[model samples]
Target: MTIFGEIAQITLRALLGRRRTLLMLLLAAIPILVGLLVRANARPGPVDVGAFLDAIVIRVVLPLVALVFGTAALGSELEDGTAVHVLTKPIRRSTIVLAKITVAGTLTAALLVPSTIVAGMLIAGLLNTRPGSDPITATFAIGLGVLVGSYLYAAIFVALSIVTSRGLLVGLGYALIWEGILAGLLPGSQVFSVREYVRGIAETLEPSSIESIVGSSAVAYAAIALVTASVIASLRLAVYEVRGGE
Candidate 1:
């Protein structure tokens, strides 16, 4: 196996072999459960389903999941002093950081994508809800949006792990306070919010129906540029920290 593959395997094991994994699984299931409840309560239309997904899955669950997995990907290793052993290897620090963030991002996507799809599909069925667009297409688009957001969040939180041992606390604060509250209240701050990026991507995909609820003003190219920049900057910071420890 390649060095990146080896590091990713170790990261996967480290992340999955914990009680927190179970908690994350439960967390991922929350949207599906809520979808079931919504279906039971009332026959919600496409717009309502889109709004529910935007409010619950995109805004709340995605960040929380990414925060947990992303920080734990490297944070636990550093805290337990196991990362020093990996650092001692004849491997590039960039490779280590890349592998760690990739694993973290992929895991976050894997858990949330299906959850988002199922919840959206359950709330808005495979049938066409309107003339041009369908809930199924919008649902899959949102799932892809979650996939994009997961990697961005993972990269940011992985770098946070390197910068501080309190990565979880710091990430949680950023998600809940900065992105959740400040971004909502201060419209200009939406430029710095990953939630807004996700909304932008999703709105771009299913523009006709989801635009009203997702309410993102960011253009697709700008959102892509911001996400790409964040990921590169995050990986650079993580690599620098790892190399500085040498």
Candidate 2:
């Protein structure tokens, strides 16, 4: 437990450096800032604020931030050879992977959820009449969905980081091309999409307000995928050949 705590602490410090922390704050604040500006400036009329928020926050911002933090958690260490010392420690590799996952997931959620809730509230307020889902329900749904997405995405990216130096770029391609475009366009792709898992949860809570292609049943697959990725990551790191620093 102590070892895990140390790894988590180190991971947090590495991932949350001054510039990166500022970037995360700015990324999270995107939705809130945009929502406030819209609320203040846009003329009063019937608008689908929920859908707009969904597109911007869920589809775009959430994944981008997750990619950044997730890759940074371990990928940076691997690239810079700082992880060699940690790898040589008398600790289980799974512990290291778990710690990285925990920190990355927590950090991503912390950065994302508040902005989502605030943006949801602002959008809910803008609407003169409530929709199928109440503001509270919608806010909860978005927060929950983003939380789930952040954890799952972070786990996958952390694993990718161990396997490849270009994990961030690969994650970006997957997020933009695979999950973002394919999942929406190809029904078959929904089965393998993390976004669908997130949408499934949100839609289960507020089916009308949240747009989802797959039903709640798919959430199990998402969980399984997350676990599989973590396990694979641990195994990879356990036997990883760390070389001298560059």
The models' CA-based lDDT, in order, is 0.79, 0.84
TM per model? 0.86, 0.94
Off by over 4 Å in 1: 43-47, 126-133, 212-246
lDDT of 1 at 210: 59
Instruction: Please provide, for model 2 over 21-72, each residue's C-alpha lDDT reduced to its tens digit, 9 standing for 90 to 100.
Output: 9988999999999889878876766556457667878888888999999999
Q: What TM-score number comes out for model 1?
A: 0.86
Best by lDDT: 2
Any idea how many clashes model 2 has? 0
Give per-residue lDDT, candidate 1, residue 175. 97
Count of steric clashes across candidates, in order? 0, 0
Runs off by more than 4 Å, candidate 2: 244-246
Residue 159 of model 2, lDDT score: 95
